[model samples]
Target chain A: MDPLFEKGMTELNRPPTDRPFQAFEIVFWHVLDEMFEERLLPGDVLYETALSQELGLSRTPVREALSRLVAEGLLENPAGTRGYRVPDLSADDLQQVFQAREILESSAAALAAEHARKGDIGELEEIHRREILFSSQENRREYCRANVEFHFAVMRIGGNRYLERAFRPVFWRSQLYVNYLAEFHPLNGEELTAESGHNSPAEHAALIRAIARRAPKAAAKAAAEHLRSTTAYRILLDTERARHIFGGSSR
Target chain B: MDPLFEKGMTELNRPPTDRPFQAFEIVFWHVLDEMFEERLLPGDVLYETALSQELGLSRTPVREALSRLVAEGLLENPAGTRGYRVPDLSADDLQQVFQAREILESSAAALAAEHARKGDIGELEEIHRREILFSSQENRREYCRANVEFHFAVMRIGGNRYLERAFRPVFWRSQLYVNYLAEFHPLNGEELTAESGHNSPAEHAALIRAIARRAPKAAAKAAAEHLRSTTAYRILLDTERARHIFGGSSR
Candidate 1:
């Protein structure tokens, strides 16, 4: 029989422990929660020994878990080293990731429009509706979670397993930047207003409409531009934060 | 002291391994080679125990390596108990990857045009020149190798590691399909003729010119269109091949 857990698709009835997934998978997610949840930052070192001791697990599983994070591009392990850490991206790196995400995500959205089932469109409408709900209430965390799901939902509809699988890791790996940016970018009406003044929820609404109508070209354009707006503002935020935190001389 | 390598940079000397790299890393690449060079299908089983004995290593590294591949989307490990296998793509899955690549690569090319440095442009031109040599000489392997490098040359000049890193694995991963297509595509003059009908050489030259001129929009358009052309053509070829190999009933 095929293994239960495919990527991002939850496994409700999976056995407690299995060959491919070690206990470290669970333990690793807990540690990753600190990073993906934004309680950690790049440049933070992960002491394998310490984590192994704390979790009461062997070094092997801890090591394996860390390897998974490194593969996800969230952590960097150099030269078969004992300790691992996150990569601290500069403005250049941020631009790079955002630009890539913008283009790739847009393309995914467009393709999704071509193959989208009625149910797929319905799911996206629901996600967008809930996004608006979370946005008005200013629930940043919930907004972040929903935002990821919405994008992934688009990927799911796009019918490209290869692309979906590749892109999702990138999405997870980028949590640091995404989470940090979200701190200043709240989900409230005022925050959305200031942010969306450039493109606003209207752009996303347009995207949803395009998908609903199954217009590939329009959907693609909407998605790409939406991503571009977010990245462009992300660069500005990074610049402003750097100046505020590190001073002009540092920059 | 970074053990990880980067593109187009001269390597600082380090002691070579007495054996190969880690067993799992070696096996991962070996399997990836099948994806790239040998046409390992999407759902092909990659067994740890068998490969471990072959490599004269324990299953530990092999298992860890499989996890890394799973994260990369090349191999999927089902959630519960089972061995790891490279997952097959539905037509939708393949479409998503190329679509994403099309957008990102196009944008990168456009950006390369706008921001590519003189030296970087020179380097890309150099790579293109090599492609001419490989193409005319009828060395299929060399031509394909040169082709990948030439595209990478654009990415390098684009100066976005994040974009390059994200685009390449997914792009190369499609070699799984290309490898099969090449079986029918053959290295004959007909194949070469089909390939050469496009002024890719001229497009490369034009892209370099745009980069030198720092025309970002032009570069982006050229790059995006270039990818779309390739993706569309490849899909056509895939359809034709499926019809031929599996009979018309397959489609």
Candidate 2:
């Protein structure tokens, strides 16, 4: 069993009434956290029995959590496979994921610009503020979390629950690639410099400004350009660097 | 009990080994078919126990089917509510769904233009051919299904499973509206004539031609324009007509 499972066992063993969380929700977040932290790498196979036994829980909730993760595209049960594995996204997969993100998030930004309230703008600003702080302090994990929060906040401001729901899985799948990028090219490293076309913080600021000003076209353009730059950065990494980031898990 | 439940019970009674279908999958399709056929109208609630009893199956599969439908946005388990209800989409909801469809399907068209092989183009042409046939024959349900197949074929040709997955639920939700529109305005009626701007068969042909010629920009523009025209036709349906179509179920 992976050591990461042990890390969350104490919390999982708590009395049911002690917290409002369900067994499957607890397990889901635990595994998701492990993936985001890189403690669970791509190609890591997660067996239901092993996970349930490690957590001292029944196989039911364990299965539910794994199945949900698989449905969300964060994990995959390959054809004829039993256990779920953290997906080893290839370059083509990365391209497709980014392309989907560009479409969804740009439209989300446009909607946010048209529909966002003052309170919504404040919420977005707060998330972006924390994102900048996390970047400045070199907190990679929190930075990733805050970055995700910023995009999700914009989605919420879009005032379309369906759009937000559709964006959720695609956003999380792309985050896996973002997390990998963060691991190889640190937050403040030279690779993310303006010349590398990966200046997300600055790009995020521009997006927020457009939304705050209620400029729908500008917001959409800003969001698309930001994603395009990110895609360009990913492409520039080259196959050799991608191999390093994926840790020999590229399929 | 809904009479539609009785319609599929005969098929559901087959022995487990007779077919490879799961109980939950059968239930899922049965419910989905009812929704698409408009036998299950907006604001109709579906309970697990009731569905299980009607289908002569256990609550487990019934619950699974309903939950999957809820997750897919076909049905909604409203907050503080117990059973799933066919969603009562408002005009804003319709707008949001169309916006999402435009973004996803247009991108899918562009990607298909770039990546589609001859076989994929042939597949799309076949679906469009059926769509026109059904349209001329005044077959609403088959026309709708072929229309869906046409778009899905484009998504498949895009070579991005992720994009197709993201588009599925949104497309289905939009189909509900399309079905409602069809109920109020027949396929060959004046409301869908050239002046009313609801010419799907012609638009589909244009999209296919663009894809066949490998014109990515033209394909994307055709897709976007097609959805925009559909949205326009939806808006043209006054609130009174919408109420009649939804059977006073609009929320």
The numbered model that scores best in lDDT is: 2
- Native-referenced Cα lDDT, model 1: 0.63
Worst 10 residues of 1 chain A by lDDT: A242-251
lDDT string, candidate 1, A1-251, tens digits: 12323322122212345456557775566556666545566667788889888778888988888887777677887766657876775555566666666666777788787888888878887877777877777665555456667778887787766566566656665555655544434342343332333343567789888888889899989987777666334444557554442211111
C-alpha root-mean-square deviation, candidate 1:
6.5
Q: What tens digits encode model 2's per-residue C-alpha lDDT throughout B170-248?
A: 8878877766655554343655632223278899999999999999999999999888787334554455555445444
lDDT of each: 0.63, 0.73
TM-score for each of the candidates: 0.79, 0.83
Computed on C-alphas against the true complex, the DockQ of each candidate is 0.46, 0.41
Clashes of each: 13, 0
Per-residue alpha-carbon lDDT of candidate 1 for residues B1-251, written as tens digits (9 for 90 to 100): 12322211111111244544666666666556555545456556767898788767798988887777776767777765477766654454455666666666776787677667678877887878877777677666656666676777787677766677676667666555455444444342343332333456667677777777888878877776665555334554466444443211111
Pick the TM-score winner: 2
